[model samples]
Target: MFVQNIRNICVVGAGQMGHQIGMLCALGGYETVIVDVNEDALKKADTLLQSIMEKWVTKGKISEDAKDAAFSRLQFKTDLEDAATNADLVIEAVVEKLDVKRELFAKLDKITPSHAILVSNSSTIVNSLIADVTNRADKVCNMHFFYPPLVMDCVEVVMSDKTSDETAQTTMNVCKQIGRTGVLLRKEISGFIANRILGALQREAVHLYESGIADYKDIDVICRKALNHPIGPFELMDLSGIDVGYFVMQQRYAETGDPQDKPAACIEEKVKAGHLGRKTGKGFYDYAKEGVKN
Candidate 1:
């Protein structure tokens, strides 16, 4: 279905990306329902949405009336079936795991209406594999949005072999309606475009850190000033969360079999210790102190 035809959109997952994505859709005037199995995660998503909207209001980027309208457009649910049953589109934004995502897709396929579009917001997983669980593969595709979906305009519209041209076109129209720039990829790839660039940088940064050439923060400074990049690799990595980075990189490395794709040994160690960046208050760098910690 096209944007004008689309009414209720169900977003599965209430984590960081999921919440932001749902908020963006609601702001665009879609009836949005964000679902998560975890009650705490659902509550957190609601709180995060409020915080983001409040920040925009404070910056005069959005009016109080706009914020009220956006909030009214959004809803939250803990049940999967309730969210998917009547949705015009169901977008899965849950954790990045093959089996977990596959299972959810299978469940959503069973519960969602036959015409409902099923999409994934995966950064590195193969779009085709994610479409495998559903019988309506023609309506299954990738709608990869960048970090902070509200601020970012670019969204990668990925089409797998089973993805229908109609579905792809409709998704593009939906992106336009939401005020996002949509780029099409004909085939499924591990990291798509943006993540592929990020993957390359991640591999090199890990290699640099592992080789004892420089500390994490030192490397971050060089990238920021010398390259005029907005955020240094190490600092960005920490903010992205070490566990999430390690998860994506490990899968990409395994898929590509590229030695450069492998994360540094320190990453595994840190993740094992639960130092998962800003959320944990510690990662490659200590967010609390605003610097790297060995």
Candidate 2:
């Protein structure tokens, strides 16, 4: 149903996930606009995209003409209403907080085109909770993409009870056209698929370390070399930002109210110290002066 009319894409937030997701939409030949009140953050996204696209050219993945064409499709707007004026789809990658998302979506509802599909890139918080805040709940769903959306192929297409079949299908179609491997979740649940499995692994990894069964580094090695993972659990946490995991766990704990449901003490401490994974230069391991592997 959404094959022809979809064109303009609006992304809210220019943070780590937001900018990359907007870039991917541009690569899909859509007229993409990243909306953020923070001009500095948007400028950073511009700089980051230029660097990433240049690397693509250097690797012979995309021609100069293709790179320029994709770059031409990228745009930015500081005002949410201005950006979503005629947007066919709106993907929000803002901070992973329920009230914050509800407030944003409520505002987006007033400004965006009625037909525009609103989706969130929240890792733990489900769209079911946020969709209700908008009158266009039928058009709202979750389109959770992996970290570094530039390289990752997966996109989770989640629908709440209010999400119409057409809306869900349209979201999946959008994913396919953008070169994403879309996984549909028929049932509404916390954490969807990937994060649920990942959370299970991380929980055990933390337990093993806390219980003195093994150090964090040793656990990472076993997951990497033995399990054939590109990066270990600890490394993944660092790359995706330790603070991100902390918030996710906080949401989950609120739902379950279990002590074990809370974020690990170690993860909480790292965030308090401002060692937020690769971005801050340290988390589970130090990355102040070396590559992620080091």
Candidate 3:
């Protein structure tokens, strides 16, 4: 019902999560535009998306005709205003910074149609902090899509007190349209649901590794073999990017000023060394040897 009104979606950012999200929207039959300032990044996103679609075709997950139709509905643009002017929904996938999001929301509030909804794909930064910058606070909420949105099936739809019921319901409808499960949080929280649980597990894992209780690989093995988990915490960090976790920690610490919320030493070190997981070909484990790309 709510989904019927959202015909066009503007995804701001063409990086990892942004590109995949744009693809999902396009496949859902929404006219989707992904905007990025860097032309090189847009080109890379196009190439990667095409490769992923081809893999889906080969896997029989989607027909070649379906892939072609999805690509036809998707567009890449450098100008934000041009991309968002007619957008019925805008999902921001930019950097995990408060100021950046606030500024972007402010601009989007002015550029988009009055009825458009503005959502953030931030993992930790809550929408409450960003919504106040826009006049349509009732339409601003968090639609947190996990990393690699093409594969992940769950999206957290978080709402602040100011968010209207219509806004939250519409977002959930959008999720269903894209063939993903949507979990709605009536109250807003910094990390929402999944990441809060994941953060605790990761913190303990990092503590065990730093304490020399067990090697990171050994811990990961125990998690996979004994606990029946799909991947170890360290491996997940590498796949998601160590710098992303580092930034999430930084945001949490800034909000709470708690020492425990600061990034783990190993994460900070890895980020500083530019060893940000599969994207950099290194993180907790070396991916260069395996020729893996995230």
Candidate 4:
């Protein structure tokens, strides 16, 4: 089926990532269902969407009518099967765990229409592992989105060895239709494109910090001023959450067995202490208030 023909899209998760993605789809004129297993999560998505709409209105980015139209295009649900029953594409954005993803796909495969495409927003897990739980392996692939999916234009499109050409084509087409910059991956890799490259830089940054070669603010300045990157590796890690960084590095380590994949002691220690970056107000730098604290 043509990507533009996919009118009904189901986003399976209502967390920060999933909510943003579903809102983007709704704004782009697709019939989007934002589903979560927990009713509270669905409620939270609704609240978040409302806040976003309000912000857009206040900023004069979109009219009240447009906000209403987008909200009307979205449906929030707690039942996965109900949300995906007639969906043309279902994007899973749940917790990043192989077992959880496998089990979700296993059930989703049975519930969704045979022709519906199944995709994941996973950053590390291989498409092969997730597809193993589903019968429609050909239609299963990774459609990874960075944090705050609505704002990020880049999407890593990953297809496993078993992924069919038709599936890849459709996914790429869908991404284009949604106004996203899509990079196709011919085969599975540890962290895909952006994260893999970013991870390498992060490993070195951690080494620099741990070895007292540079402090947090100085390193951040060098990266922003010299590298011209939007944010330094350490700063970005904090915003993305330290636990997420640890998980991605752990997955990379398991896949490639490379030394770079091994996260720094600081990362492991922060995660163990539940100091998961901005989300928790502490990681490499303190977010206790304003200003960066090392």
Candidate maximizing lDDT = 3
TM-score of every candidate:
0.95, 0.97, 0.98, 0.93
Candidate 1 lDDT over 1-294, as tens digits, reads 666778989999988688988998898889999999899998888887898789999999999999999899899999999988999988889888778889999998899889999999988887788787789999999999887788889999999988999889888888887789999998888889898898778678778888899887888888898989999887777766788778887877778798767767888899899988777888776667655421
Identify the runs in model 2 with alpha carbons over 4 angstroms from their true place: 291-294
The top-ranked prediction according to TM-score is: 3
> Please, what is the whole-model Cα lDDT of each candidate in the order they appear?
0.85, 0.90, 0.95, 0.86
Backbone clashes per model, in order?
0, 0, 0, 0
Predicted structure 4: lDDT: 0.86
RMSD of each: 2.4, 1.6, 0.9, 2.5
> Where is model 2 poorest over a 10-residue stretch in terms of lDDT?
285-294
Writing each residue's lDDT as its tens digit, candidate 3 over 123-223 gives 99999999999999999999999988999999999999999999999999999999999999999888999999999999999999999999999999999
Across 5-26, the per-residue lDDT of candidate 4 in tens digits comes to 6899999989868998898888
lDDT sort, best first:
3, 2, 4, 1
Query: TM-score of model 3 relative to the true fold?
Result: 0.98
Indicate the residue-level lDDT of 218 in model 1.
83
On lDDT, the stronger of 1 and 4 is 4
lDDT of 2 at 213: 98
Lowest lDDT 10-residue stretch of candidate 1 = 285-294
Model 1: residues with Cα > 4 Å off, grouped in runs: 289-294
